[model samples]
Target: MPLRSIQSAIYTTTMNHSLLFTRFTVSLILCFIASAAVAAVAADKPNILIVFTDDQGYADLACYGNEANKTPRLDQLAAEGTRFTSFYSQTVCGPSRSALLTGRQPLRSKGWGMPASEITFAELIRNAGYQTACIGKWDVSNRKAILDRMPNAQGFDYYFGTLGANDGGRVRFHENNEPAGATDDMGSLTTLYTDKAIEYLNEKRDPEKPFVLYLAHTMMHTIIDASDRFRGKSAGGLYGDVVEEFDHETGRLLDVVDDLGLSENTLVIYTSDNGPWNQPKYTDRKKGHPEGSIFWGQSGPLRNGKGSCYEGGYRLPCIVRWPGKVPAGRVSDALFATIDFMPTFAHLAGFDVPRDRRIDGIDQTDLLLGKRDTGREHFYFNNAGVRQGDWKYLKPDAYFHGYAIEADRKKVDELYNLKSDLGEQTNLAAEHPEKVAELKALMRQIEGNDPPGTSPIQIK
Candidate 1:
């Protein structure tokens, strides 16, 4: 038959109409399959477990640079993950924790340190239909107002741990509002919190939706009841014992996740709230950070220890581990502050953090995933130390660093090459007058909302 004649015949009958209908059905089926595949890829969100430590130093973990301390678990985590070299925190507990949870500077929050207006990281994670829980210290407020400023009030489905009122009255462990279990008065509270976290991981985790577990351990913070497993078993003395104990707990969490087949799908971040607090204590107590009069944490060449805005106090270790996604056994010197956690996590979970308020943190997801080289250019630090990038432009002066060391330095201004001199020993203001002025200008721009010279407490 001729081609045109055959075509005409094929289109003429009821059978031809049925054949066309079958063709259309197959095309629709293929389209549906393609869409389903795309959806599956889009829905594979990773579970986030941010392990925030209190008063941990830049050289606290074996993975980062601690020579005397033993952190086997953390070392292994780094071996299997990327370690952040230029990670920074707010330099103190309450304020730094606030920034991580809220994605904004503590100065903007208005309640002194952590304040109240900000939302928790758990809350943001919860909003995305993920299971959210904060299982550790809730030091946003004092003892009385703890529940009001609780992890639940902030965004967690559940809140465990303590409502610490500084180092003296810091609570040990609580499951929800009640005490987790009554341990001996001098018992190590860090282990209790860790145990609670593990319990939550085993029991509360729902497979249908991903979970956000904020394991804010008060490990090195205090009530220095060393874990039974690590007591007197490290090279760095008592401080090493505390760090090692915390590392053991970390190992347990990671092992639990791996054993349950959740390791590949989970993203774990290990960081500290601030630098170690080295309060002068002439004696070792039966419990807590109070036991050690002097802080044993090594600043690793950074000037001034915790409670001040020097590199020792503000800049600390940051380690991230995500199987197959984050680079394994790698180091990135990208500068990232604790405040970037919310934006980074939100971006990973396929959403944007709200731009309703000015956020100091940039989405550091690229830095975390080893995709970006340089971290955020400018970050504000003001938990006893206020600095903007290379210029050591203190909020008004540089005595703040001296204040933490309990010495009264003259109200002399300072400028240093942070890249070349991380210790901040040499004063560059006299030599590089132009650079000092440039950094001061940069500080004004980066500060955005913080007011300068508000506090009147001088070191001298």
Candidate 2:
């Protein structure tokens, strides 16, 4: 039997082993290349930046109909993208932010901040591999127990802003769950928030990942202030001065995006939580408000201002700019809401909307992309106890702001045709009872038989 046969077998075995090792190495290299390509594609996904203003009225922006307060940058934003005529948010900040984040009605979520059970847009986008940040006034909750209820816990990777309103001189600014400091001077707030947002984009953001930056501003609301640079800048007085500075800061933020060559790939959205805060003092005030006098923001032709269930309260001023994606200089009458943003962003990021919970927001991706002209046939006004379209029906003795209906009007429903009567001067309830019934049915369906009620009369 022989040494020759054993040597041949050993040589064949060694050759086979070498061939298998070479194949395995080649396979590993191909897998690494494929994984890198996938990451690159994910990084190139469009960036979403929502610049939400505080208590800005529907007609506050110059392009929105204000000729007194100059908003060149915001006007330019409208010129560069589609301006929505019928965008909505809740009547107040807390509910509005919750609705925007979770795609559910604020009442549907937990008491104040977003419920732990709900899935946030941040979490969804992050799951799809995007960086998330909330960099402004976050009024979702006043509670401090649950860190998970905060932005850091909800979904945002970074949180740097005030927990609640900037009024009362007791506002505490927090950064990622820790108290950063007390925000004494409200005048420089817009600039500070903008700087932080830019820092996140330039320094904190990962170059290999797409990001969502929610820049919620703290301006135009009550107890307002403006930096010295913007103090005497507008003809509309103190209110006008604050608005102008907000516009300037917005322009600065946009400039950063363009300088970074990310304009085309970034989606910039500018809007407000609700309408203007027009109280007793602000009604008779002129453009140049006197010293020590409070100035409530204007709502142009809309009836009433913030905290009321009227059009001026919930119908927010909205501007969306996405360079080539959204058509420039296009004005749309599409009905949209802040709640819609969660689903819309998820759609754009190629992520699935959470199916485990009830999401009130409808997908408005087609409307934003200019593939459609209309969206959301019916929009429920949470504060109003009414549903709007062409016809708006107010429940019997529905209380708006602090004014209740007189005895004669208490038993009767109030109806207004928003299309023909934007100011809501006429009550066509008796004339259009059928339309009243239709809207009432819708109100009950959406709000679950909750009779028309007020929200403790928020002044300013």
Candidate 3:
């Protein structure tokens, strides 16, 4: 053909190519915008930060009536959130951690014997598209470095700190299933754990995904100590010093949350694993401590301390802060426990609690959100006793591991109306046999056909 005909063909082909390129570019930009919107929606889920302390007592903070230990930061936290007056954990550390993680009683979770099969809140929340991290003591693996039962296998994306408690005045650290190092300087843990948590919030976590940071501090457990700046700084002795240091470090963590503009969307929970080791039996354990250190924590009006089936052993100080969600400065006397967390998180994070096994935790989202004041009509204490409404009943042979009371003295079923007798000084079992029988029946019902390898104190 002619030169004019060839030029026309070339122009038409070139124009068609340009149109295709423009359409492809527009499609790419639209895809990018859609991905960004999805990320924003995921980030809208609330962040959960749980600061769990070891062996802290019911009255360790000034907000809880501690006269010697100064805890202005925690006092302010209580003032800024809802303080739970009838909160409870387990009688000891391992059981408490297991209960908190599995939302089951020690009888079902198996405490130190918690198997790899047990599911944790971390697993469920992480599966629901949240970043999960566990920092500090993890006593659920029976203190062993069991790979299947460790944090990584149990659903945490990042794991730092010890697999167990700082028992023996030392702890060995692990970062994501690998050994990091060991430390005997017990005083360094509070600050160190807080630093790790801050690092996670600032650098490690994914910005586009909501996160769960379970910072379980190991301070105030057995063989407690305080750093140089905190030592001898309080009137309540070394234990008091540790408590004050914890308060300051927690304040620092909260400040970082504020600095990152996460205050409104981050749900902060501060609670203890169990009550302090304040019994007379712990006297020998404090032999090497500084003179007049008063290593044990005060139980306030509670009758006994850790390892007893009494108020002090189970009751704990719990404060929750989620601005504009949980009512500020409200003090609630509703009965709740660490075992309730799994189901509550399921409600908040949009996940399902495990249905194959028995879960002892009642969903407490209503209580936390201030929609309801009543929580847990009945809470069983291991297999030894049970509390219903205001009445708590203990069998004649309820196990007491920490104290040295004679067996003969406990020959009769004891009962107390905790509403009026917080100290448990009055025994109302003889006057209220009907209530005793009712609670005993509830305890037996909770005991249920126990699976093998459970606690030996099954209700008869």
Best by TM-score: 3
Report the number of backbone clashes for model 1.
Answer: 6
Please give, for residues 1-460, the per-residue lDDT of candidate 3 as tens digits. 8999999999999999999999999999999998898677665568999999988989999999999999999999998899999998998888999999998889888888789999999999998889999999998888999999999999999999998877677789999999999999988999999999999999998887889999999988877889999998988888999999999999999999999998999899999998888866566556545566677887899977788788888899999999999999999999889988988888888898886777788788889989998888888898569988799998988877745243335567989999999988889999999999988888997888655333223111
lDDT of 2 by residue, 1-460 (tens): 5899989999999989989998998999998988798767765578999999998888888998988989999999999999999888877778888888887777676435566766789988998889999998877666453676788888899999887885564467889989898767878899999999999989999877888999998887666889999887788888889999999999999999999877988998999998877756444443433365455777888887777777888888889999888889999988888988887887789888776666678778789889988777777776455655577888765545442122233546879888999887898989988988888877767766233222111111
Between candidates 1 and 3, the one scoring higher on TM-score is 3
Q: What C-alpha lDDT, on a 0 to 100 scale, does residue 316 get in candidate 3?
A: 92
Better of 2 and 3 by TM-score: 3
| Each model's lDDT | 0.70, 0.80, 0.87
Give one digit per residue, the lDDT tens place, for model 1 in 1-460: 9999998887787677898999999999999998776546435878888888878888777666778887888998888888887788876677777778877777765333454566656766676668888887777765444565766777888887776633563455556666665444433666766787788888887766788888887666644546567777778877788788888878888888898888888999988888876644322332344454233576777876677766877888888899888999998877678877877887877665665666666777777777777776666666333444455655345434333753544455566677777787777667877766766666555556434322111111
What does the lDDT read for residue 340 in candidate 3? 88
Q: Which residue window of length 10 is worst by lDDT in model 2?
A: 451-460
- Lowest lDDT 10-mer window, candidate 3? 451-460
TM-score between candidate 2 and the true structure = 0.87
Q: What residue runs in model 3 are displaced by over 4 Å at the alpha carbon?
A: 1-33, 285-292, 403-409, 450-460
Mark the 10 consecutive residues where model 1 has the least summed lDDT. 451-460
